[model samples]
Target chain A: MKEEIIISGFGGQGVLSMGKILAYSALLENKEVSWMPAYGPEQRGGTANVTVIISDELISSPILNSFDTAIILNQQSMDKFEPKIKPGGVLLYDPHGITRAPVRKDIRIHTVDATEIASDMDNSKAFNMIVLGAYLKVLPIVQLKSILEGLRKTLPARHHKLIPMNEQALQAGMDRVK
Target chain B: MKGIHLMKGNEAIAHAAIRCGCDGYFGYPITPQSEILETLMEEKPWESTGMVCLQAESEVAAINMVFGGASCGKKVMTSSSSPGVSLKQEGVSYLCGADLPCLIVNIMRGGPGLGTIQPSQSDYFQSTKGGGHGDYHLIVLAPNSVQEMADFVGLGFDLSFKYRIPALILSDGVIGQMMEKLRLPAFKPRATEEEIARDCPWALSGRTGMRPQNIISSLELDPAIMEKRNLERHERYRKVEATEVRYDTFMCDDAEFLIVAFGCAARICQKSVELLREQGIKAGLLRPITLWPFPKKAIEGYCRQVRSILTVELNSGQMVEDVRLAVDGKVPVGHYGRMGGIVPTPEEIVEALKKNS
Candidate 1:
């Protein structure tokens, strides 16, 4: 089965990064995947987002009008993307940031306190990773070991030590969801 | 081998060019294409693989540098956006006239004058039709993705040297800015200067008294000789039209409607196809990977099968003329798109497809 997801937030919220990490993880799992960002000027600060589509077959389009899931890191993103999520899809949010949750009952909404958890981990920058952790728990689409390995390879050698901490943060977020 | 990376289209082209063994890159710093030079500068392929990269002062100087390197029988290339490419047109026309092989890349932005930095396919006419004066053609390849942005450089360079003509990689700001997963192609060494000179008897490499002096100029003071030259170039273009038209056809075999697009605009058309399929409309896309040798045969073939053909572009119907020529009134061809700075989304294209179908 193919699953398409979009992560939307302000420019620096690591929305594109979340989509990329998931796409890379899906690649490691041997699925055909594509990640495309909302490029050009709109990417500066207004709302930056990326769409990730993972499938068993070749992906025809990189654009997604409707998504299986959406990770909203801010209220603006929630307002912009909430109406676009496919019926019966999922909407994951960060409790520390997103205040106005989607009013739709057709889709499932899972709110996680990612900002607080990252703050507790002594690294607020890992908030995106925390979301990935919670996402892994719900989907189980990729192996945690495989994602950690992908992290090791994707991160630069200089920041290689950050991999384990990020993995820890991911597992912590996964545990919170459980 | 396959994973997402945070890289611009220009950076990907730079990496791909070096690995593809492009003998040299001669270019000036233009906005969108600047990262290509920056990436090449940081990588310094000259130190690793003896690849030559130079930052020329002007677009004229850059294209001249390309001409010089190409005349010596090396696979040289140059890149710029629309305005910069317009400056290099003089050199490009000369390269074509001299029958020298080289590749030129245009990472097109908008405008008849200093347009915005956003993506635009407005240069479709300038690229497809001769940008410079005189009867000459550059084999143009339009790539819609970052993957093709990297991959087509090698193909463009290869075709240039193979055909003894200039090839162009016509891209836009969208493809240049977007990031995606790319498995770097195998690195192949460029053909040596001596190896290339052996095939062409007329290369200008310090001709001795024993050998005839070589002249590289498109101007023929004599009308008959110019006419003959034009005929010879026409013959070459005929061969290219017959053999070098490359395209990607999606779901067109059973299609009732067709969408013709190229470069980044074509990628959106792919999305339109998916949306149309969902709506139970039999739609297809014919993406012309090559812009010049305009994939006329494929369009002609589709004309007999499909009811209507929609030509989508980022310009004000530049390629539509060619599409009409290809279809030749066998079927109705409609042109729909935006110009300046707006990018046509899949939904817009889907609406056009549904209306045309």
Candidate 2:
């Protein structure tokens, strides 16, 4: 199966890393994957996004005008990507600073309040993981084992201690996503 | 080193250079591609493999450092985006004229001026038709994937040395900033002093007691000498064009329509071909891996099977000139592109094709 996912949020909201981890997890499974980021002034306070494609066959385009799933965090992303999701695709988002909710009825829309959840957990940095967890729960495209492996490959060894916490956050997301 | 590791295209370039026994990397960090320098600095190839990584004061300085390294027959390179590359044009021209073997990586950003920090193919004319000055060509290799980003670092050097000419990895921001799984290349040991002396007989290394001094320069007082030098380089260019032309044809067997693109544009067109096929349109894609050789013959060959051709690029229209020249009116050649760093969608490409057809 081929899945095209776009994750967009504020630059510091870990949007790019969320896509990177997902792409890496897919790579560990020997899936052909490509991750293209919206690299620009977005690195500051602007909206940042990344397009990730995972497939059994080699990926053709990393940049796309549409996606099978769009994981949005900020309202700008919701305003921008809500219309771009393919019909019957997945729209998983964190309803934290989002003034405008996704209006698309063709795709599945699920909110996880990842920011509030992470704050409740007393780990603000886990906000992205929580959102990612919600995405995996809705799609289940990649397994937790692959995700943990992805974290190992991505994070420096000194920070591997947080992997278990991230796994827990992933579990909470799966449990909380409706 | 056969494992598949996920990394950005820029990071892959850095690791590839270190593993490929690159002697030195002289560069100033620039956006979208600054990761190349950052990764190299973090890896500290100096401690591990004795490879020197220096952040030169500017693009001009870095390129001249490349010149110094190439003069001594050392494997060296520098990378930058479009504006930075523009600043190095004079040095690039000198390297081409001196017949020095070195790698130059341009992870291109949008341009006419410092257009934007976005990916663009506007530099196609600059890269293929001699951006700097004079009648010189860089063995231009356009990579569309992270794998090719790793693979080309070593391949670019080999081709540059083999032909004694500068080679360019003409990539764009999308390819450089994008991430994909890469099968890491095995480490190659740095060339030994004896090996360098033997392999590069024309090197500007210190002289031995028995031989005359080896001088490397692009300057000449006499017009005849300069013309002769230019002619000799042209002869090598012909050889490169004949022997080193590389391209890929996808689903072209029964295609009635064709799309020709390089680098990232090719990737998008590949999908467009698939989408077109779903609509029962017999479409195919031809990707030029070597932009300099232009793949004129291969493109010309496709004119027989395909009724018409569309050249897709990120710029308004740069590579289309070459594509049209290659087609030679055998079939209609149309151009589709977006300017100012906007990438054209596959749907837009299909629209362009239908309109053109």
The two-chain DockQ for each candidate, comma-separated, is: 0.39, 0.74
Interface RMSD of each: 2.8, 1.7
Off by over 4 Å in 2: none
Give the distance in Å from residue B315's predicted Cα in candidate 2 to where it truly belongs: 0.9
TM-score of each: 0.92, 0.98
Backbone clashes for every candidate come to 0, 0
Q: What is the lDDT, from 0 to 100, of the residue B206 in candidate 2?
A: 75
> Candidate 2: lDDT of A97?
88
lDDT of each model, Cα atoms only?
0.83, 0.91
Each prediction's RMSD to truth: 2.7, 1.2
Chain B TM-score, one value per candidate, order as shown: 0.95, 0.98
**Highest lDDT among the candidates is held by which one?**
2
Best by TM-score: 2
Candidate 1 segments exceeding 4 Å error: A41-46, B1-9, B29-34
lDDT (Cα, tens digit) per residue for candidate 2, span B1-357: 248888899999999999999999999988879999999999999998899999999999999999999999999999999999999999999999899999999999888888899899888888899989889999999999999999999999999999998999999998999999898789999998888989999997678756688889988889999999989999999999999999998999999999999999999999899889999999999999999988999999988888999999998888889988888899999889987888888888888888878
